[model samples]
Target: MTKILISIVGPTAIGKTALSIKLAQHFNTEIISADSRQFFKEMTVGTAVPSTEELNTTKHHFIQHISIKDNYSVGDFERDAISKIESIHKNNDIAIMVGGSGLYVKAVTKGLDHFPDVDKHIRTELNKRLINEGIETLQKQLKSLDFKAYQSIAIDNPQRIIRALEVCIGSGQPYSSFLTKTEKTRPFKVVTIGLSAVRSIIYDRINQRVDIMVNEGLIEEAKELLPNKHLNALNTVGYKELFNYFEGEWTLDFAISEIKKNTRRFAKRQLTWFKKDETIQWFDYTTDINNIINYLEKQS
Candidate 1:
C-alpha cells in the first residue's frame, strides 16, 4: 500500500483552511501548514491564522510553532515537515499538508536543491544598500542578474530581493540556478489540489479579509510585533504596511489600501508560482468540500 500526502494549495482568502480542515476531519489525520508567515507564534490575525475552533476541529502542526526572531527557511521546513509527515504516516496511511505558500509546499513535495550558505558580509552589505538605496535598487539589480527570478519574486520586496541577491553573489551564481531541475522521488504518493477563483472575486475577498483582520485587531497585532519589525517575518504583507504607518511614511488609510494592494499582488505571484506545477489538480473555489474528499479517497 502506498502512503499518501495530499497538498491543498491556493491563493489566500480562497478557503484553503476550511477545505483542509474538512479533509483532515474526514480522513482522521492531522494537517501541516505550509504557510511561511503564519509560522511565527506572534503573528495571528494579520497572518490570517486558522481560528481556535477550526484548529480544535482538526489537529494542525507547524502553525504558530516558530518565533519571528528565528531565521526559518525552506530547507528547514522541508526537513521538519518530512519528519513530521513520516511520523504521522506511521499511524495513518494518509496525511494532509495545506497552505498558500507554494515554495514551502514544493520544498517538501519535491526536494529542494541545497544552496550554499550565504556570506554574512555580502548579506550585511546588501542590507545596508537596501536600507540606504531602497527596494527599487535591489529590484533592478536582480532583474539585471536573474530576470526569471526577478519576474517571479515580488519586485517591491526589499528583503526577499536582498536575500536572493545575497545567495546569488555569495555563491557566484544566479539565485534561480539553485533550482537546477525538478527531480521527484518520494516513498509516499503525493497528490496536489489547487483552489482558484475569478480575479475580481479573489481581490474582493482579499480586501474584505483585510478589513476583517483590522476588526480582529491586526493593527494591534502589528503594533506588538513592531518592536521586532526588523525580523524577516515582519517583512510580510500586512505587517509591512502597518510598519509604514508607524513610521509616518503613510497614513492609516493609505497603509490599509497598500496592504490590500500588496496582498493582491502576492496572490498573483502565488498563482504564478503554483501554475508552474503540472501535478496540481485545480478546482473552482466553489467546489463542494465532499467532492474533494471523495476525489482524494478515490485516489488513495
Candidate 2:
C-alpha cells in the first residue's frame, strides 16, 4: 500500500485545525503542523496555537518546536517536516499535515523553487532600508521590481517582502520567475484538502477569532514578547497590531480593529494563492469530517 500524507489547508479560523485533529484520530496517526507562525514557542495566543486539549487529544509534531529568535527558513522546515513525516510513516500508513501557510505546504509537497545565492550585503542593505524608510518603501520597490511577487506574496510581511526584493535585485529577475510551475516528485501519495467559505463568512470568522484571541490574553502574550518584538516571527498580524498600541501609535480599540481588518486581508491573500492550485479538493467549512475522510479513502 502507498503511504499517504493528508495535508489540510485553508484560511485562518476556518476549521482546518478541527478537521486535522479529527482526521488524525480516525487514522490513528500523528500530525505535523505546517503553519509557520505556530512553529515559534514564544507565540501562542497570537498565532492561535492549538489548545492543550486539542494537542493532547493526539500526537503532534512541530508545534512550538523552535524559538522566534531562530532564523528558521522554509528550507529548514521542508527538511525537518519531511523527516518527521517519514518517521510517522514508519509506524502508520497515513500521516497528517495541516496549516494555513500555502508556501510552507508547497515547500513540503512540491519542493521550493531554486534561487541562486545572493550577496549578504544585499540583504543587509534591504533590512537597513526597511528600518530607515519603513516597510511601505520596500513594498513599493518590490511592486515596481516584481509585480507578480507583490501580488502573490504577503506584501504586509516585511520578511517576505525583503526576501523577494533581495532575489529580484540580486538576480536581475522577477522574484516570481523563480517559482517553477511543475510539481516535484515526493516519496508518498499527497492529497490536499482546502476548507473554504463565502467571503463574508470568512471575514466574520476571522473577526470572531481575533476577539477570542484577545479574550485569551493575546495582548498579554504580545506584551511578554514586546522586548524582542523586532524578531521576524512577531511581525505577524495580531502581535503587530498590539505592538502598535503598546508603542502609543494607536489606541487599544483602534489596534484591535486593525488586527481584525488585517486578519481578513490575510485570509483573502491565502485564498488568492490557494485558488491558483487546481489540485486542492475544496470543501465548505461546514462539511462533515466523515465526508472528507471518505473522500480520502477513495484517493488512497
Candidate 3:
C-alpha cells in the first residue's frame, strides 16, 4: 500500500482541527500540526491550541513542542515536519497534517522555494527603515521593485513586506523571481483538503473564537509573556494587541476588538494564499466527514 499524507488546511476558526482529529482517529494514525502559532509552549489560549481533551483524543506532534524564545523559522518547521511524516508513514499507510498556515503546508506537500543568500545588512537596513520611515516606505519600494509580490503578499504585514523588500534589494531582482514553481519529489503521495465557508460565516466564527480566547484567560497569558513581546513569535495578532493594552496604548476592550479584526484579516490572507493552489480538494466547512473519507479512499 502507498503511504499518503492527508493535509487539512483552511482559515482560522474554520474547523480544521476538529476534522484533522477525526480523520486521524479514523485512520488510526498520528497527526502533525503545521500551525506556526501553536508551536510555542508559552502561547496556548491566544493560539487556540487543541484543547487538552481534543489532544488526548489522538496523538499529535509539533503542538507546543518549542519555546517562544526559539527562533523557529518556516525552514526549520519544513525539515522537522518532513522527518515526522516519514516516521509516521513507516507504521501507517496514512497520516494527517493540519493547520491554517498555508506556507507550512506547501512546504511539506511541495517544497520551500530556494532563494539566494541575501546580505545580512539588507534586513537590518529594512528594519531600521521600517522603524524610522514606517512600513509605507518599504511597501512603496516593494511595489516599485516587485509589483506581483506587492499584489499577492499581505501588504499590511511588516514582516512579509520587509522580507520581500530585502530579497528584492539584496538580489537586485524581484522577490517573486526567486519562486521556483516546481514541486520536490516525495516518497509518499499528498492529498490536500481545504475547508471553506462564506465570508460572513468566517467572520462570525472568528469573532466568537476571539471571545472564547479572551474568556479563557488570553489576557493573562499575554501578561505572562509581556517581557518577551519583542520576540517574533509574540508579534502576532492576539498577543500584540494585548501587549499594546498593557503599554496603555489601548483599553482592554479595544484591544480585544483589535484581536477580532486582525484575526479576520489573517483569515482573509490565508484564503488568498490557499486559493492560488489548484490541487487542493475544497469542501464546505460543514461537509460531512464520510464524504471526505470516501473521496480520500477513492484517491488513495
Model 3 C-alpha lDDT per residue in residues 84-131, reported as the tens digit of each score: 999998899998999988778888999989988899899888878876
The numbered model that scores best in TM-score is 2
TM-score of each: 0.95, 0.97, 0.95
Q: Each candidate: what lDDT? A: 0.89, 0.92, 0.91
Task: Name the runs in model 1 displaced over 4 angstroms.
Answer: none
Error of 3 at 201 (Å): 1.1
Measured by TM-score, how close is model 1 to the native structure? 0.95
In terms of lDDT, which candidate is stronger, 1 or 3? 3
Task: Spell out the clash pairs found in candidate 3.
Answer: none
Q: Model 1: per-residue lDDT, tens digit, 31-75?
A: 999998889899899989999999899889999998988878888
Candidate 2, residues 1-300, lDDT tens digits: the string is: 899999998899999999999999999999999999999998899898999999999998989999988989999999999999999989999999999898999999999899988898999998888777999999999999998899878888998999999999899999998988677888899999899999999999999999999999998899998998767788789998889999999999999999999999899889988888899999999998889999999998
Where does the lowest 10-residue lDDT sum fall in candidate 2? Answer: 177-186
Q: On a 0 to 1 TM-score scale, where does candidate 2 land against the true structure?
A: 0.97
